[model samples]
Target: MRDLPTFDKTEIIRIVRRGYGIRVQKIIPYRHIYRLETNLGTLFFKPFHSKEAKLQLIVKAQEHLKKQGFTRFIPFIPTLNGKPYYCYKKQLFYLTRWIDGHPSNYDNPFELRKAVHLFARFHKAAKGFAPPIEIPDFLGKWPLMFKKRTLELKKCRKNAQKYPRPTPFENLFFKHIDYYIEQAEKAIELLDKTDYVLLSKAGKRELPFCHHDPAHHNILITSTNKAFLIDFDYLIRDLHLHDLASLIIRNGKASTWNLKRCEFLIKAYQEIKPITPEEFAVIHAFMTYPYDIWLLARARYIEKKPWPLTYYIKELIRKTKNEKARQYFLDKFLYSYLLL
Candidate 1:
């Protein structure tokens, strides 16, 4: 919370009123979650690090969704000046209609199946909407991120040496990161060869109509068993596997999903849109992307990467607690993405 600013209910209400031209009786800000609530409804808001590029991308995503007739997405609100984005205290802000539905956690097979199906639909629908706006290159900092993370892992190891009976997870992570670095070149090659990639001639892969970050929490399930998606902040063109890989990795650690559940999702997704064989070949590498994020988080923690490092730590701990989660995810994701 210290890394970001806050807006009181009254403050948020004024912003909403001006942006949407609607009055609200109450406003509650969910700081950790990128959303603001008011009596009129829940209006999702994301504070851009005052980056105009990020703000414009969000506006573009909203407009793209609207044009495509995708109803399951959160709609954006215009600012007081009739602009899709606005600046407040040097931070860019955008509002969207708060979607009313319960967020699914994949506690059961049905929910897990539904989650995958919905994700597939999102991918299929997104491909149809050609965004005229150009997205700013945000993920291009990965090489630097990797270098910084290597240093942080060293610090973590150093910290562990001074402490008696250090955390079990830290030692395990030490092995994971070291092993990942050893195999980094292989992983990169696999990524390059994967059929799921939409690469351009310059060697940079085509960013899939990316959801940027698609965790279970960003998925919403309405009472009618319909799913809606939110949080377009991470929307950029990138690897498609990045989306499914992160979802499977995150959920597999927290809960165990049966093979049947996994199959259903993949089947449902294929029904809506198709997956390529090349993408199937690299399911293993995709599952490892979270590890990449962990390395970045470790690096950013020590170097102070100018973004919240706590989320990284949280995800790391999450995977650590479910030590075998990655293997299970690969098993299911590969089985689904490749076999069934």
Candidate 2:
């Protein structure tokens, strides 16, 4: 792993004290993070990846949430110069207070329900957020993107067919390519039937933003069962159902593709904010899509993940271990989806 910049101990301490005005007792490095044991407490310092203006937009948007009495977001600590970030040798860095919590347990029913409620509150609070300039707006991109992925899956199937010497992974991929491709196409077809294709308005009132990455790590649960969302880096103005679909996929995969668990998550979120019938239909399109298996194939065939053949085989098997239940889950969700 790469260390931080080649700054010595004195230079590092000087940088922190001058820019952030905090007296550091020790500087600890863990991978890409610099943990500052300061007089204030434990703080995390890291180099900001995006542009300064984008960071400003994030700060303003998050600060607005805080003003609206939403306390779930972790705000960026201002620099000594009243900026959310600092520039040293043309590299950007920022600091924030650390959360002393572990990753949320998907296996815990209580924590998972809390996570759903947290997501609902977050979406409701984000209703009035409107950035002045265009950022990473993902509204209306899903339908077209889904169409493209379907075609990409078809191309992978062809490539696998022509391999002079196919590996075990390729053979396994070829075996299931038809099933996943069929699901991808079905997802696209179902999306065409929804109101998602006709969405024209792009304002915050029409479509609220979603905390795009809802993986286990990004969500932290404290002893009080409070959920704290750490990273605002991937917030996008998209359908809130997109976020719910992601949560189901992230958690449902661990539950052996249990349909009842997915239903419970949806019901919990609806207790806070009811899902409209139209949004419910859109979510069905997202949930039934075989995104995980398609992504695994895309990584090996399209993106060319440079790993051993057996490694891909192992991951593919693990991802599809409960395939029989995946089909059942899909059928159960599809029954209600057709009634919609």
Candidate 3:
């Protein structure tokens, strides 16, 4: 793990103790995580860098879910002043009762199945959450986002083509630019064909708040085989299928887009929440977007960052190698499921 910023340990301890009315015996820092051993119990403390309004919405959403009898989510513990977080040195931090469980092991089929079912249950409980805060128009701008990413890909291709003495990274980028651009254009076409606004409007009455980042690491499995979701930083109002697509894409990458594994995941989730045909089409469109490829291209070719361009280029190449399997999976499962 990269070295994280150093903080005044005494100040943090004092803040936690005073704000939450707990006795913190020790504070162990692991990367960006602060594990506190307190008289009340073990607490996990992490930095809250998001806006206060967003943080408030997250806290309120968790409270709403908990009130709806969803015990699997960890709610933010309020400070002594009834605030959801404590601000020190212009940085916000929040605490939660530490779960004595590891992240769900995606490699284990049984655990993976459980995680899928648990996610569907979460969607069910998260329905009807209307945060007072004004949610962003992310769904309304879906096509625009895809178009912007496609433009970025085009710019990257142009830059790579014009470089007289291109680096190895540039060469690899140039090699696959055509394919990536094609995939991106195809994504935009699919988005144009989808009536996302109508779908969103149809579900407005019971619009589900999605866990924007529902990767396996955010899923906790207790020693007793119970599963819980952590990390609500990116919670937003969207189709629950957004969460499902995120799960399948991330897990499919781990298995090199294993068609059987992807099918199993969809089936496992369906057992809890059956997906309609139209919803399946939306999911397929989302899965076909090649988000990872676009991100890598932009990071390596367009953006200036501390990381070496070689690293991003290598990732792009790795993803490109797995494209065949991903395409096959999409054709076999997504198309067949949509009856297209």
Candidate 4:
């Protein structure tokens, strides 16, 4: 790395000693994460980017998982004072013991199945969590969420137009933004047309929670074939089919969007915990949504997350360049699985 900022590393070292009572042997920065070597073991440190209330929910959810006999989740290592997080000058940080494993790659079929199995286990364990009064249930809000995100695409387009001399990313975005917007609208239309979603509204505890962002790096498969879930940042009381859709889409791309590969992954998950046809409809809607391109747009334009411009250009191309393969794949999956 380029020399880190003035206050970040120093403050982290100071907080680690004062709060966790551990002498940091070395600190390696991976984007926003800190991998530290300590006397106890290797651990990872990360700052809370969202509300402290969400952090509270995550801690409770993980505790709930443990009580339900779920052992694969990495726990948030507490401070010396037994607090889940350490506060220093208004910044909050937490730690977790690093697992000795490699990130699961979707390209590897065996590891993909293991990740799917562990994911199903996670969903099973996350069931029956009567969330605290403060934590919100998202079961009925998914339709509204789909609508909102679709509307956000219009706003993203307007923001892109405001650029006087549009960057390459913006130009590339303009080229395919309409197609993705159509995809988003298609998702909303599917959800609205599906009679199953009528039950999705005003339902209480009808759905299991999800690991919401179960990216490859978040799942680490060990030599023993055990998969550990690392990040607990976006846990929510949503349909676990959203998680299944995420798993399918990520791996679908690796399989060149092959329908058989997608079917196999879904089969692996069902062998552990079954998915209903209603859930399949919702998953179909989720797959219809252009999540990858939308993520890049929301980060670079909407949230203005300050990611490097080159990263934006490269990722946008990678996500949109193979549009034909992606669309054909979705059509095959829709006809085969969701046609009922």
The total of clashing pairs for model 4 equals 0
Between candidates 1 and 2, the one scoring higher on lDDT is: 2
Write the residue-wise lDDT of candidate 3 on 1-340 in tens digits: 2554766679778888777888888999877778999998899888876688878888888888888878788877889998888887777889998889999988899899989998998888888777778765355566788889989988878777787998788777777778878888887787677777678776687767888997888889999998998888788778888899889898888998887888889899999999888777777888888788788777656875567766766777787888788888878875568776
TM-score of 2: 0.91
Model 2: pairs clashing at backbone N, Cα or C within 3 Å: none
Model 1 pairs whose backbones collide:
42-98, 149-299, 195-278, 196-279, 198-206, 207-237, 207-238, 208-238
Tens-place lDDT digits, model 1, residues 1-340: 2477666767766665666666766545565434554565666666556467666766676666666566677666776678877665565666677666888867766776677777776765565434566764433443344445445555655654665664554555565555455444444555555543333222253334668677777788888888888777677665455576566555555456445544555566677667567655755555544464345535543554555445555656654554464456555666655666
Error of 2 at 54 (Å): 4.2
Q: What is the lDDT of candidate 2?
A: 0.79
Candidate 2: tens digits of C-alpha lDDT, residues 277-307: 7777788788767788878878877888787
| Cα lDDT over the full model 3 | 0.82
Q: Which of the two, 2 or 4, has more TM-score?
A: 2
Query: Candidates 1 and 2: which is better by TM-score?
Result: 2
Superposition TM-score, candidate 1 onto the true structure: 0.71
